[model samples]
Target: MAVVLLLLKTVGVLGFISLLIFYLKKIRLYRAAAKFPGPPALPFIGNAHVFVGSTEDILNKIMELLDTYPSPLRFWLGSRLFFGVCEAEQLKIVFTSPKTIEKEDLYKFARPWLGTGLFTAPASKWRVHRKLILPTFNPRILESFVEVFAQQSEIMVRQMKVEIDGDEFDVFNYISLCTLDIICETAMGVTMKAQTEGDPTYVESAKRTFEIFYTRMFKVWLHPDIIFNNTRLGKDQRECIDYLHGLTNDVIKKKKLELTFDSPIIEDTKPRKAFLDLLMELSNEGKKFTDEELREEVDTMMIAGNDTTASVNSFVMLMLANFPEVQEKCYQELCTIYGANINTDTVITHEDLHRMEYLERTIKETLRLFPVGPVLVRYVSEDLDIGGHVLPRGSSVVIGILKMHRSEKYWKEPLKFDPDRFLPEEVAKRHAYCFVPFSAGPRNCIGVRYAMMAMKTLLATVLRHYILKKDRTVRIEDIKLKADVMLKPVEPISVKIERRKH
Candidate 1:
């Protein structure tokens, strides 16, 4: 009885100490976050309760908060504090600041699927990898991929021919397949045949992986690996990641074999080197990347190269379908550029892509409405001042790109879908950081030029062949937005397609 009483007393003392540590940490967070305006946070839990619901609902809540709160607001997720910045001035500071370059802790969730690739790697590693890969995207090299983009787009145009029967269909899925095909060929130097073959094992696994990862991001209970790895979601995530890694590994092995036996002179004759070929060359020259590192980068490129361009292309088509005048303007521009060749089997030259100014504006406007990354998150390594608010070290800051793009202060008629908003004169008038579909500053998207080439090629090619028409029932406002790393329309974007008479 005396021993039992002693054990109980020890337990009581430990509990008291635990409570003391919790409150001490809370006090520190409260002191740092107190200066900023935010929703009231309860003890221990903070504002975690505010994040309940489906991903769509959660995004809506965030948008509402953006509308209600002033810039540089504090958001507490349990005991962790995150500063949300939406205004251009604040975003400039966050994006350009050297100290805030590391990705937020939330990105660790992707490590299982993407590995420590460029997206998930530390700033130091990312800087080195980024430099090594930069040469692969030089203008001359990108120009070589034009043929790949054109070929893939031609296949897409052919596929759309069967669907042009006055029935509306989801355009995003088809475009996604085409983009996947492009990435597979350009990044891995393999033909996935995603559009022609339907959903392959790798494609399906990737889709599931992303869906599960997004789900885990909201369900905090699953954040612990011990708990998550035992659940069905965890099991599925592991399986999907294995398949994805296997696919990338296979591609790497095949490329390495080709490099070993193939003659360098023959390789030199090729029109353009694939991204893998460049990496292999670097490896052969002693600037090596481990097999694991190569896999990580391949996965990163596959994800980055496919989704962002596909989303933009799909959104652009939706916009063109809804806005007939804008569509007509784009068609006219194509008519002028392609002229007699508009309806002919003509190749799109690099110069032709350069001449697509108006179509470029439409793409920019679509991005403003739905930037691929709705929020750009970064880890604050040191205490910093942002728009008059102090963000303590170890905190995370999220630049609300979607909010800033649509904010009334920067955009006139913020909700209106007007392509001319990106005209050179108009763009010059606005804050430079106000519209960053590809993000900005030192760590900006390395594939911006590549993405633009792919998007412009697909869009211009499609417009040349078909007239895009919106589903009669779908309105601009009816399309709900959801954030799953990338922002996407909740409902499939269905459009009626008609063959254009040359």
Candidate 2:
């Protein structure tokens, strides 16, 4: 009895001490965060309730917070301090700082699917992998991908004829599959033919995984592994990840067999070397990446490269449809580059892509209004100052890309969809960081050039074949957006297309 009582007393004392230390840390965090403006937080929850509704509701709440608070707005997610920085100057500080290179803890939710691929890898791993993969996106190499982009885009344009002259239909489904096909061919040196074959299992699994990840990101209860593993969503995520991994592994296996020690270089005769093939050549040259690492990168390319491009192209299509005059201008630009008879079969060369300056501006404008990545989360490794405010070390920062893009302070008549906003004169007048759909800094997206090239080629192809249209009644303001693995419309991006009457 004496021994049991003594153990209980010790345990009780330790628990008290732990709680005391936890509160002390929390109090300090509160003091540090109190310097910035944000919504009042409740104990323990700490503004978590703000993220508790449907993804659309959560987006609205976030936007509401951005509207109410000033730049470098402070908010807490549980005990973690999050500063929402939307102003260009503040964004520049967070993005360019070496201390903020690491991604925030929230990205861990994607690790089960993405592994430690470039998307979810730690700063140390990311630095090395990014360097290795950087050469693969060389302009010369990306130029070779023009053929693949044109071919896949032609397929997408042909596939969409079914929607011709019909009521508005969701274009994302078609666009996503097309991008999946393009990424698979370019990333893995294999053809997925996702568009021609309807939806593949890998495609379905990946989509489901993204949805699950978005759900887990906001639901705090799903953060713990033990608890999450026991739930249905967790089980579903496991199944999806397994399928995705299997597909990537199979591709890697076949490529490894084909790549022998004798021929370290893939023949120039091949239309183009896939990103995977380049990595394999490097591995063959002795800078070896494990089979698992190869899978991580290929999967990352598939998910990151495919989804963002698809979303941007889809949104651009919708925007073009809504503003017929903008669509006509883009078509006119395409005509100037590809000639008046530009049709579904027209091939877009790399030079042609560069010449479509107006189309490029339209794409940029769409990205500004509806960037696929609405927010980028970074971990502050050291104390940082922005706009006379201190963001303490160990806390996180949310670079509010969406809010910043739409902020009236940076953009005049911000809500208007004016491609002219990207004209050289206007762009030069604004701060450099004012528009960052691909993020900025040392850790900025490695695939920016690749993504832009793919988007331009795809858009040029589609526009050549069809005139995109949308209900003028459907204003941009009515488009409800949701936070997924990417930012997407709550409802599908519905638009109508008609065979171009030349």
Candidate 3:
């Protein structure tokens, strides 16, 4: 009896010590976070309750918080500290600082799919892979992709003819499928025919996988691996990932086989290289990238390349549809380049893409207002000062790209969709960090030039062939947005297209 009592006392003492240590650490974090402004948080739970809602509701709540709180604002997700940094100056420090190079913890959810590809790789691994991949996206290499972009775009245009002179339909699906085809052809050297095939397993699996990732991110219950593994969502995600990984593996294997057999051929007579072709070449020579590494990087390229560009292109089309005047201007610019031959189906060349100064500005403006990455989350490795406030080390910093883009302090009528905001004189007036659609700093998107070229080529092709129209008068405020892996509308972005008159 005495021994039993002693054992119970011993267990109680250890438990007490553990509790005390946890509280002490918590107190330190609480004190550091107390310096910033935010909504009053509940103990233990902090502001976690606010995140439990539909994706659209979650986005609305975030926008509300952005409006209420000043820049360098604080909030907590369970025990983790988060600071919403929206001011351009504050964003500059968070982005450019060497100490803050790592992505936040939530990015780990993507590791299952991306597998430490450039998007989710550790800072050290990212540095090496980034250097290795940089040469593949050279301007000359990307210029070669214009033919594929224009070809895939023509397919999308032809498919949309079914909707011409008919009632409005969602244009986002058509744009996404077109982008998927482009990415598959350019990134994997495989013609996905996503537009022609109409929702293949690969495309469907990828779409569901992104939704699953975003769902897991906000739902705290799904954070634990053991619990999530037992759930239906987790099972579905696993199947999707397995299929995706298998597809990438098959592609890599086929390319390796082709390279092995084709080594005797001369370079000039060979086919134009895809990103995967370039990567495989490096892998074959000097044993650079492993089989796994190749898969990771290619999967990253497929998702990153297809999704962001598709979202921006869809929104740009929606914008043009809503604003007829802007559509007219864009069409006029295309006319000048194509020489008033509206019906002519000429392939968009790299030289032709550069002449699209006005269209480029329009795309930039769309990015500013509805950036596909509405928020960028980075980790603070050490105590970091943003403006005057110090973010405690290990805290997650959520850079509110949406808020920064629309801040009244920086933009004139911030919500207004004015492509003129990107005019040379107007651009020179604003802080560079205020308008980061591609993000900024050492980790800015590597695919910026590639994406711009693809979007311009695709948009130029479509505008040349059709006139965009919308059923209802639209405003920026009218579009209800949802926060997912990407920023998208709650409802489909619908528009009508008419065959352009010659």
Candidate 4:
């Protein structure tokens, strides 16, 4: 009886000590985070409640917070504290800092789907991988892809032609499928035919995977592997991941059998090497990227290359539809480039893409309003000073691109969609990091040139053939946005496309 009593007392003492340590750590974090302005946080839970809502509601709440708080604001998600910065000066320190290159814990949600690909890998591994992949996106490589872009764009134009019966439809669906086909052909050397086909398993799996990851991010209860795996959402996530992996593996296997290392093939005479072929060549040489590494990169490129460009294309189309004047200007620019003979069959060369300067600006302005990734999150590796606040190590820093883009200080008539904001004179006056659609810094999107080529090619082709008009008049303020892995509109962007009178 005495021994039992002593054991109970010992257990109680240890538990008390553990509780004390936890509270002490919390106190320390609170003191450091106290320096920044933010919404009041509760003990233990912090500001986690703010994140509990539908994706659209969560986005609205975040926008509200951005309006209320100053730059370098602090917020806690359970015990973890995050610093949110939306000003250009503050962003410069975050993006350009060599030490702050690591992505935040929030990116871990993508691990199951992407593995440790370029997007989610550590700074050290990212450097090596980035060096190897840089050549894959060179101007020559991207120039070769113009044909693929033009071909796929023609397919998209044909598809749109079938729908141009003076009726409105969600433009995102067609555009997303077209991008899926483009990425598959250029990145994997496989034609998914997603544009012609209703919906392929690979495309569906990718979409489901992103949606699952987005859900896991905001819902704290769904974070732990043991608990999540047991749930229906978790099971769905695993199946989708497996399906995507299987599809990529099949593509990789087929490509390996066809490529030969010894052959010194001429660039023009031989077929153009896909991005996967380039990666395989690196592996064939002494600088070997393992099969797993290859898979990660291929998967990353497939997902990243498809969805982001698709979102931008859809948004740009929507913008053009809503503003007829802007659409007319873009059409005029296209007319100058192609002359009166411009048709759906027009082949868009690299030189032709550059001449659509106004259209490029419009794409930039669209990105400013609706950045594909609304927020860029990084893991603070070392103690840093941002906007006079001494941010301690081991905290997450979120750069709110949406907030920064629309901030009154950096933009004139920030809410209005003005392509002139990117004009030479206007651009020169603004901070270099102020307009980062593809992000800025050493880790900025490696696919920037490829995406631009694709967007310019596709948009130029579509505008040449049709006049896009909104089906229903919708104001920018009325359109609701959702905070997923990517920024998405709650309602589909429906537009009416009319055949141009040649």
Which candidate has the top score in lDDT?
Answer: 3
**Candidate 3 local lDDT, 144-257, one digit each (tens):** 899999999999999998998999998878998999999999999988778988976776788788888887776777788999889998999999999999989998888878
Which stretch of 10 consecutive residues in model 4 shows the poorest summed lDDT? 260-269
List the candidates' TM-scores in order: 0.97, 0.95, 0.96, 0.96
Cα RMSD to the true fold for all candidates: 1.5, 2.0, 1.7, 1.9
Clashing pairs in 1: none
Clashing residue pairs found in predicted model 3? none
lDDT of 4 by residue, 1-502 (tens): 9999999999999999988998787676678888889999886667878888777877777778777898788988778888888889888888989768998888888988788899999898999999999999999989988898999988888988877866889888888888989999899989898888767577678877887887777677777789999999889999999999998999888877666433455433556878998998899896578888899999999988888998899899999998998999999988888886676476889989889899999999999999988877898888888767877887888788999888788898887989988899999999887878787899899999899889999898899888898767677778789877888898887899889887
TM-score of model number 1: 0.97
Clashes of 4: 0
Each prediction's number of clashing residue pairs: 0, 0, 0, 0
Cα error of candidate 4 at position 178, Å: 0.8
Higher lDDT: candidate 2 or 4? Answer: 2
- Worst lDDT run of 10 residues, candidate 1, spans 470-479
Model 4: lDDT of residue 86:
86
User: What shift in Å separates residue 160 of candidate 4 from its native position after superposition?
Assistant: 1.7
Quantify all predictions' global Cα lDDT against the true fold: 0.86, 0.87, 0.88, 0.86
- Residue runs of model 2 more than 4 Å from their true location after superposition: 1-12, 261-268
Residue 289, candidate 4: C-alpha displacement in angstroms: 0.7
Model 3 scores a C-alpha lDDT of 0.88
| Model 2, position 391: C-alpha lDDT score | 90
Best by TM-score: 1
